[model samples]
Target: MKIQTKINGHLREDEVEPRLLLVHYLRDVAGLTGTHIGCETSLCGACTVLLNGEAVKSCTLFAVQADGGEITTIEALGNHEKLHPLQEGFWEEHGLQCGFCTPGMILAAYQLLCRNPHPSREEIRKGLEGNLCRCTGYQHIVKAIEYAAQKIGSPDA
Candidate 1:
C-alpha cells in the first residue's frame, strides 16, 4: 500500500505493506529510528508519537492507518544544539538512566504539557501512567516534566 503522511514537518509518500506497523515504517522505511520499538503489544510506550497533534502508540497502528496524517517523532523536537525544554529537563534532572524510554516519556509529557501546561506532580504522574521506565524510579521523570512545565509556562519561555 502507498501511504502519504507528513512526518517531522516533511511530506512523505512511500509504499508499505498493509500490515506494516507504524513503528516499523518510521524506523525501517522512513529511517526515523527515534521512535523505539519495545513491547510491541503496547504495554510499553516506547513507540509513542504525535498523530495529528494527539499522542498515539505507533506500535498499535498500521502504517496505512497513518496515511494522510501528520506524525511527529522525537526527532522533530529540538536537537542537541538547541534542546527542547523536555530534553533539557531530562538532562538537568537526570530523568533517564538507560535512556531507552526517554523518547516516549518525553513525547508523552509533551502531550500532557500541551493539554495542561501547569501539571501538578500527581497530574504528571497520572499523565504518564501509560509509559513505564525501568530506570530513574520515576521521581526524576516527574521532576523533569515539572521543569518543562515551568519553562514552558514562564513568560520568558
Candidate 2:
C-alpha cells in the first residue's frame, strides 16, 4: 500500500507492506531514526510519536494505518540550534540517563502540555503512564514536565 502522511513538517509518500510497522517505516524508509524500538509490544512507549497530535506507539500500528495523518517524530521536535522547551527542560532537569527513552518521554510530555498547559505534578505523571524510563525513576522527568508546563503558562505573567 501507498501511504501519505505529513511527518516532521514534511509530506511523504511511501509504499509499504501491510505488515510494515510505523516505527520501521519511520526509522528505515523515512530515514528518521530518533524514535527507538524497545518493547515492540507497545508497553514501553519507546516508539512513541504524535499521530494527528496524539501520542501513539509507532510499533503498535501499521504504516498503512497512519495513512493521511500528520505524524510528528522526535526529529520534528527541534534540534541542537533551537531545541524545544521540553527538550531544554529535560536537559536542564536531567530528565534522562541512558537516553533511550528521551525521545518518547519528550514527545509524551509535549502532547500532555499541549492539551494541559498547566498540569499538576500528579497529572503529568498520569499523562506519562504510557512511557517507561528505566534509568532515573522519573522524579526528574516529572519535574521536567512540570517545568515545561510552568514555562508555557504562568499566572505571574
* Whole-model lDDT values for every prediction: 0.94, 0.91
79 Cα displacement, candidate 2 (Å): 1.5
Question: Over all chains combined, what TM-score does candidate 1 have?
Answer: 0.99
* Tens digit of per-residue lDDT, candidate 1, span 46-153: 899999999899999999999999999999999879999999999999999999999999999999999998999999999998898997899999999999889988
- Give the TM-scores of the predictions, in the order they appear: 0.99, 0.95
Model 1 segments more than 4 A misplaced: none
Which window of ten consecutive residues has the lowest lDDT sum in model 2? 148-157
* lDDT of each residue in 1-157, candidate 2, tens digit only: 9889899889998889999999999999999999999999989888999999999999999999999999999998878998778988898899999999999999999989988898888899999999999999999999888877776676652
lDDT of 1: 0.94
Backbone collision tally, model 2: 0
RMSD in Å for model 1: 0.6
Residue clash pairs of candidate 1? none
Model 2 C-alpha lDDT versus the unseen true structure: 0.91
